[model samples]
Target: MRLLIIAPEQIPVPPPVGGSVENCIYQIAKQIKGNHEVTIVSLYRKHLPRTTRVGRATIIRVDGGSKSNYLRNAIKQVKGNRYDLIQIDNRPSFIRAMKQAFPNTPISVFMHSMTFVSKPVTTPSKAALDLGRANLIIGNSQSLKRTLGSKFPAQKHKVKYVHLGVDLKKFHPSGKSGAKPFHILFAGRLIPRKGIPVLLKAVQIARRSVPSIRLSIAGGTGKPAYKAYLRQTAKSLGIPVTFTGGLSRRQMPVFYRTGSCFVCPSQKHEAFGLVNVEAMASGLPVIASKIGGIPEVVQHGRNGYLVGAYHRPEAFASQIVKLAKQPELTKRLARQARIDAVQRFSWTQTASKLTRIYEGHLNRRQG
Candidate 1:
């Protein structure tokens, strides 16, 4: 099948900087390349190539001044391309325009996250109407589907859940456990929503029980003020924090392997926690918030523990202390995490699921 995937203007398909949606698309594209003709259309940035091929998939960039203009130009650029299915990522408002552009074609809108990311100008009813036009709507998690279902009951039947996949080979056990001087790892954007400050507080509290514990942060800060605040807080608490800034995809696995445990203390409502799975894949016992779709991945007492988010650093601290104190429990959870990650989350499985969805949509359209 010929497939056209439309990504948000903020990032590219291959994603120069780390992005969940882009990485998801890249993986799906790579996995389905042998069987399908895949093309990713993204907003043009001066730094990115106009057109390039990654394996069997072709990435094309379109020039425009604004977000609206970018979408318009992207649609214009792909006007003549023949595609069996068109899959767009998390943009309900644009569904109507895209439908008008290709009236006969089957289009599927793949929702990667929550509605906050899209921020569509249209009303709820209008957005639902736009979504109704699409042949299918894919959600990354059941939490996303439930929320989207409540928001747009008219299109609820269209919603389907497909858990995001992780690269099993790249992220696996480091073959060494209970390393000396236990380290806690946090990797994500250094923003308020990521709960970086909360992690610092948790580290401070955990250190009383586990004095040898150290915190290592690996993520780029979009806001300098927040970064400053985090550094100041860490220094004030005398907590040893190492900020490695942003890391590329190639460096992520090694970073995760170096840490004894992974913490994702997000304050915001996460549609899904990709980092939690990645950490689990690396054989690290994950300590994430018990909110949103996180529970779907982190099974408490089985693979990892889920604590409360926000200002409750003590909850996180308790978990960290527990893992540090109990070496046998930590090793058990880490082993289970790796086994679960490999069994449940694989790009090959994701691609196969997506392929079946694509075929079903195409068949329905043809019929």
Candidate 2:
């Protein structure tokens, strides 16, 4: 089968800068490419080649401007290619044009987040129409699927949930011994929605119980004011917080391996928390908020603990304190997290299931 994936225009495919959606596109394409002919279209970078082939897949980067330009260029580049399936990532702006370009082709629109990151796709009527044109609609989590279904009941039947996957081999336990067992890690954009402030407060509370507790935050900061506020807050609270700006995919493994636990204290609803799975894969116990699709990933006292109430510092602090105190419990959770990651959330499983989805749709189209 020949497949083409239309990705977001802002992020590069293969993710040199590091984005979950970009990583997802690359990983899925890489995994499925062995069995199918895959091609990806993403934002062009001056430093990278315009077109390149990785494994069995081809990547084409185009110069981007407005969403209109992206849509036009994407359709132009992919015009002559005979693809078995077309998958558009997140942006609804490309949908109408792509559908027109490949009239008979089966197109699947994947929604990785709750809302569009692009301004053009945020328009309700246009987004609705663009969404309606897809042959199938896929959400990264069931939580997101529910939200989408509720918002656009007409497309409910088309909506399906396909949980994101992590690269197990790349993210596995280091097996390296003797590191700081109380080191907490948070990786994501330094934004209000990520619940960074909440995490800082939780760390302050946790340190009262476990004095050795520390936090290492890794992610890019678009809002300088917010970043400065976080630093000042950490200082005032006297919580030892280290902010390592924007780690690439390569740098993430080291951070994961070094940290004792992963905390994703997101105040806003996460479509699916990829960090939880990544941490679990790295053999670190995860402590995430019990909201959105996070609960779907981290089971309370099973693989990891979930902070029940939204942004409750004490609740998160208590979990950290418990983990610090009970080495045996932490070991159990970490071990289970690794096992679960391998069994349930590897890229292999994701690829296989996605293959079924594609094949099922293709067969129906043929019949």
RMSD of every candidate to native, in Å, equals 2.1, 1.7
Put down candidate 2 lDDT per residue, 140-196, tens digits, no spaces: 889998988988888899998888899988898879655364989999899899998
Number of the predicted model whose TM-score against the real structure is largest: 2
lDDT of 1 by residue, 263-295 (tens): 999997788888999999999989999888998
Candidate 2 matches the true fold with a TM-score of: 0.96
Alpha carbon lDDT of each predicted model: 0.86, 0.87
Tell me the TM-score of each prediction against the true structure. Answer: 0.93, 0.96
Query: How many clashes does the backbone of model 2 have?
Result: 1
Clashes of each: 0, 1
Candidate 1 has a TM-score of 0.93
